[model samples]
Target chain A: MQKTASITIRRKFRVGNLVFHVLVIAFALFMIYPLLWMLTSSFKPGTEIFKSASFLPETWTLESYTYGWEGISGYSFGVFLGNSLFVVALVMVGNVFTCSLTAFAFAKIRFPLSSFWFAIMLGTLMLPFHARLIPQYIIYNDLGWVNTYIPLVLPKFFATEGFFVFMMTQYMRGLPREMDEASRIDGCGFFMHYWRIILPLTVPSIITTCIFSFIWTWNDFFSQMIYLSKIETYTVALALRQYVDAMGNSYWGALFAMSIVSLMPLLFIFIGFQRFLMDGVTMGSIKG
Target chain B: MNGKRREACAGYLFMTPWLLGLFGFTLIPMLISLYYSFTDFDLLTPETWIGISNYVKMFADKKFVGSLGVTFKFVFIGVPLQLAFALLLAVLFKKERRGIRLYRAAYYLPSLFGSSIAVAILWRRIFNKTGLVNQVLALLGIQGQNWIASPGTALNTLIVLQVWQFGASMVIFLASLKQIPTDYYEAATLDGAGKLRQFFSITLPLLTPMVFFNIVMQFINAFQSFTPAYIVSSGTGGPLNSTMFYSLYLYIKGFGEFQMGYASAMAWVLLLIIAAFTGLIFGTSKNWVHYD
Candidate 1:
């Protein structure tokens, strides 16, 4: 009787486990189906995009990719990709360097009103970017910085991205302060302590900042729309917008093709540095 | 030189770029926006003082009121549902030992590209009358509405999109769940506590802090959601203004209509509302959100 009861309990547990696995698999498939559908649709002819229910292309073709590469008006998709790359690369470099600098000051340095300034930085993080839009536009217009990558990448140089600064500060705070003291005893100054001791040790946080900055800047559309008006200066996000004119004909096939193309670099970065991204997000949450 | 003095100097030097950016970009624009909110400056005209007329007019403006209601509904409805779904999934996934990493990456892929133009457009396609969603409904022998184009379901479609990208919050929840000491569960099991009881008594309290954080962040994001609505609605927020998100309407007012002064007032009001909500969340967090 005892042996049969134990067997029954074990069988119940197995059933529960199977149910759990099946549920998760079903949800995962649901989560990924739209993306898979979009991918297959990109390879389908323009007329076939909406007609097919299956996520596989019945008639595989590369015509959409060619048409998308041709781009709208005179600007090819290459220009948009180049523009996005240039902007995202500069912004990523600026964020890693400048945010770390500010973070170092906040974490290790002894400054007057340092806590107050740090609070102010945190405050800026909560403020909606839309609140600053009109005035920032006017200022950029005055400076002739509108329609330029300057508006896009220049803020990174100043460490205006408070999230990165906060993340780096948390990372820096966790590091051993003895290294700084040890380096100082050896006649190293503030910059030397930073360059030799602090910066190298904060590699994880730095990489996190770089990966996030690249992805955010690459995917950002609103700011790009606000600042960039000319076709020549359009980023990938903005360039994608040009494919779908609200009042006119929309090149859905070309749009899907180009979108898939545009998302490739981000996917590559995400797949490669997913651990950093996950760590960054979770760390930022706990610390913040 | 004294160590304190030298350190102070170095600190100030290090913070120079950020301070300049704060004053130039954030602070100055804020002040200018405040000034613009009270004026009638529309890019072509000189600044004319209008006092609280813009604010007063905001209350009377049908579209503004409609957008505000829509946004409030979106935030309140979307945030909790998203967080709940994320937590549920996180709880389930925490125990799974095999292929978990691959599952996580797959789930996270949507959020990575959630706000992109491509995804937004794809969302529109999926919600169209002849789209995949309807096709699936047909398979199940149930008719599907034109989800994106219809007034009744447009905003809900947007809400579904918002909830679909809950992977980030799920990650946070999973992290928090992992932080919960296993000894609690072990002890509860020894006491013959069921899974539901343990979850409520142990997991719920411990996860509150992370839940609060996700709530605040997601609420803020929902309010600021522009790209998806913009792309999905083809920049018009049409089908009877069902998906007229606040930011989308604000964009239309400021950029499309060039109503800089009115938009500035609208922006300040949004800032105030968001600040109040954030403050309220933080204030109330003391009661429910256990930090330790």
Candidate 2:
């Protein structure tokens, strides 16, 4: 009788575990189904996309890609992608280099009002970007930088984002001070220690900053929309908006196709560097 | 040079970029916005002293009030639901196992593209009358409306989209959960506490910090939410202005109508409101948030 009772309990436990796993898998599918639907719909014929409940395309074609690449007016979708990449690249470089340098200053160097300056920097994290939109627009307009990528890229070079600086500073403080002492005894100057010992040690943080910078810049819409008016200067976000506005239901196949294409690089980057991305986000959010 | 002198020089040199940005981009622009808020300056017209008229006028504007109401509803309802979903998922996925990473990635994917134009556009199609959501509803023998086009469901649809991207918060919650020592659970179990009881007594208390952080962050994001509403409504915030998010309304006022002063005033109000909410969170945190 005891043996039978034990067997029944074991069976029940196994069933419970199986149920949990099944539920988890179902929810995961729910989370990812829209993306799958979009991917399949991109290849489906225009009319069939709405009519079919199936994920598989009844008819597959490359017409959307061809039409989307041709783009609206004189500009091509290639131009949009190119513009996005260019801005993102420059922004990433700016963030990694400038944010680290600022962090290094706050972390390693002891100077007058350093704490005050650091406090100011952290405080800016709470300041909403929209609060400064009009003045920024005016300033950029005055400098003739409004239509160009400068408005998007220039601020990054200035380490306007304090989160990266804070992350790097925390990382630098955790490093062994013995290395700095050893470097100093070897006749290393401040810049020399930073270049040889510090910069290399902080590669993880820099890469983290780069990943975020790339993604944020790539996905940014408001600043790009406000600054870049010309179609040729439009980033993928703005270009996609144009398609939705102009075509509505007319070229949805093409719209879906381009949307998928726009998300491809981000998907690749995220999938490739998820470890760094996850680590960066988790570390960055930890009360810093 | 003396060590202090050398340190100061190096620090100043390294901080040059940020210092310049502080002055030019942040400080100066903030002062300018403050000045602009007091004056009636359109982008095209000359500035005229308004003397708090813009701030005063906001009280009478129905659209402004409606926008604030919509925003409040969104932040209160959407943020809590999103945070709850994130916490629940974090708890469910707390155990280590094979293939969890793939599941994590699949879940985190939406957040990575959460605010992207493409995602917003995809959301539009998914909620349309003949879209996937309605099709699924049809399979269940239920009728579905064109969710985005209707006044009643438009805002709720946007809120659902916000909640759907709860992955970022879930990850944070997972990290916080990991920080919690296992002894608490073991001790609770020794005291004859069940799984649900331990979760309430141990897990929830320990995860309060993360819960607080996610609430504040999600609240701020929901207030500033513009893209989904914009794309869903085709930038009109239409269907009788039900989907007119505060920021969208502000954008229309500033850029569309060229009411720069009015927009600046609105921006300042938003900043103050956000600051107040943040302050409230921090102030009340001592009561409920447990720290080790």
Q: Each candidate's fnat, in order?
A: 0.69, 0.65
Among these predictions, the greatest lDDT belongs to 2
Backbone clashes in candidate 1 total 0
Residue B119 shift from truth in candidate 1, angstroms: 0.6
Chain A, candidate 1, TM-score of 0.92
**C-alpha RMSD of each candidate structure in angstroms:** 2.3, 2.4
Q: Candidate 2 regions off by >4 Å?
A: A1-12, A279-281
User: In DockQ, how does model 1 score against the reference complex?
Assistant: 0.72
lDDT agreement with native, every candidate: 0.87, 0.88
| Model 1 local distance difference test score | 0.87
lDDT per residue, candidate 1, B1-292, as tens digits? 9988999999999999899989988999999999999999878778899999999999999999999988998889988988888899888878657778877777777888888888887898889888889999998999999999988899998888888888888878887788789999989988999999999999999989888888888898888889988988988988888889999999999999988999999999999999999999999999999877
* Displacement of the residue A39 alpha carbon in candidate 2, Å: 0.7
